[model samples]
Target: MAVITTKGVEKVYNPDKIPVKALKGVDLEIEAGEFTAIVGPSGSGKTTLLNIIGGLDRPTAGYVEVGGEDISQMSDNALIDFRKEHIGFVFQAYNLIPVLTARENVEFVMLLQNRSKAERHARADELLKAVGLEDKVHKRPAELSGGQQQRVAVARALAPKPTFILADEPTANLDSESTANLLDIMARLNQEEGVTFVFSTHDQRVIDRARRVVTLVDGKVDEDLRR
Candidate 1:
């Protein structure tokens, strides 16, 4: 089944004063359990498209469907709830709460969802182990290396068990080895757990690993290729 579908999607920044068209009638579909990458040069609307797809931003025109539900017209409050319930995000900067330990960071989302403390602890442990960070559970973001922190972030994003993960330049801050390790962990999750991943990145390393690639140029899809 298609987990995400975007049709005639368009986004315009400052429409009244100085309009900047970020996306222009873009169409795309991401199926369940697919590892897809959205690639483009800077100013090509990659981030804008990712934000829209994650329901962080709204489009000027067209529809965005996640699991067959239209999220295009949701109110700000409703959109927030929808995103918490269905989507996961991992950004370039690990974005972990510095005060929280690795395990606590991973458990944070489940805490927000009102999951029992026991359930949160179990899932956090499982996910951290999945990312190969079981030994660093008590470390804070400040104590961890860039790669370790990002791994923690990955575990945190998966805590809610969202329908899919939206990762934006997730390996941008890592060194070659760290990047490879992180990618391997994510790929394993995608394969073994049937987790869908949609990434927006300019990194060739990421594009090379993706099972499908969608290239955006000048706010439009220039090429869509499957490997």
Candidate 2:
């Protein structure tokens, strides 16, 4: 079964006014354990697609199914719960809580899920170690470099062991070396842990690492290439 599936997805903004269509009948299916990238020039609706798949936005038409469940019809609260349990997100900005330490940041989601303190601690430690942030577990976001913070974000995103990860322009703020390091860690996780990752990125570095590339143009799919 596909980890994520979209059929005839469409989105429109300001329907009462300008009605700018963001997605025009998009259809896609992402299998489990696939490392895929969605690429397009500006205003091509890549982010819109990712947001719909991530459950942050609802499509105006069609459906989105994650792990065989149709999410387009879910209530807002249901979607929130569904996202918490199934989808991991890494944004261009680190989005770490400034006051929380790296370990705390990683544990926050588990805490929300009402996991026991011991379980949260153990999982946070393991994920931090997995992301190569073992030594900086106690550092706050302000104390870490941009790359370090992004690494912590990755660790936090993985803490829940979500079915798949959604990353949006994740390498945009990093230097070459940091981007390489982050990509290496993600690749390792994808290979060794069989984690599925879908990214919307413009960076060539990220595009180079993707095993499959889906290109969008003028709110529609233009190309889907598997390498």
Candidate 3:
């Protein structure tokens, strides 16, 4: 199934004035359970494209569908609800709250979804242990290593059991060992949990791991290669 798709999609920041079209007539489809990479140079609309697909931004034209729903047709409130229900995000920087423990950080996402306290704690604990952070669950992000922090972020993103995950340069700040560990974790999730990963990245390691690579150039697709 096509979990995410766009056709003739466009995002124009200034339509009347000097228009800045971040995504220009982008047409693409990403299947469920696939590990895919959206690659391009800076400002080529890779992140914009991900935002549109994830319903973080509206398209000026064309269709944007996620899990077969026309997300562009949804109201702002509905889009927020939809995202919380189905989408997960992992950014390059580990956006963990320093005041919170690793378990709290993971539990936060579930709490946002109005999950019960018991359920939240259980899910967070399971995820933290899965990421090899069981012993450090009581520690804050500041106390953990960079790799450990990133692992916590990943665990947090998966706590909601989201079908689709949008990761933007997730390995950008990591060392070689950390990047490899993170990539391995992501691969394991895709294989074991059937989580679909679609990431925007300039990193070659990410592209190499992807089952499909979509190349963007000048706000349009230059190529789509499937492994």
Worst 10 residues of 2 by lDDT: 152-161
For model 1, residues 99-137, the per-residue Cα lDDT tens digits are 999999999988889999999999999999999989999
User: lDDT by residue for model 3 over 7-64, one digit each (tens)?
Assistant: 9998898889999988889999899999999999999999889888888888999999
Candidate lDDT scores, in order, read 0.94, 0.94, 0.91
Residue 113 CA displacement from its true place in model 2, Å: 1.4
- Cα lDDT tens digits, model 2, 1-227, are 68999999999999999999999999999999999999999999999999999999999999999999999999999998998899889999999999999999999988889999999999999988998889998899999998999999988888888999999999999999999999999999999888899999999999999999999999899999999
Model 2: residues with Cα > 4 Å off, grouped in runs: none
Error of 2 at 43 (Å): 0.8
Pull out the clashing pairs in model 3.
none
- Per-model TM-score versus the true fold: 0.98, 0.98, 0.96
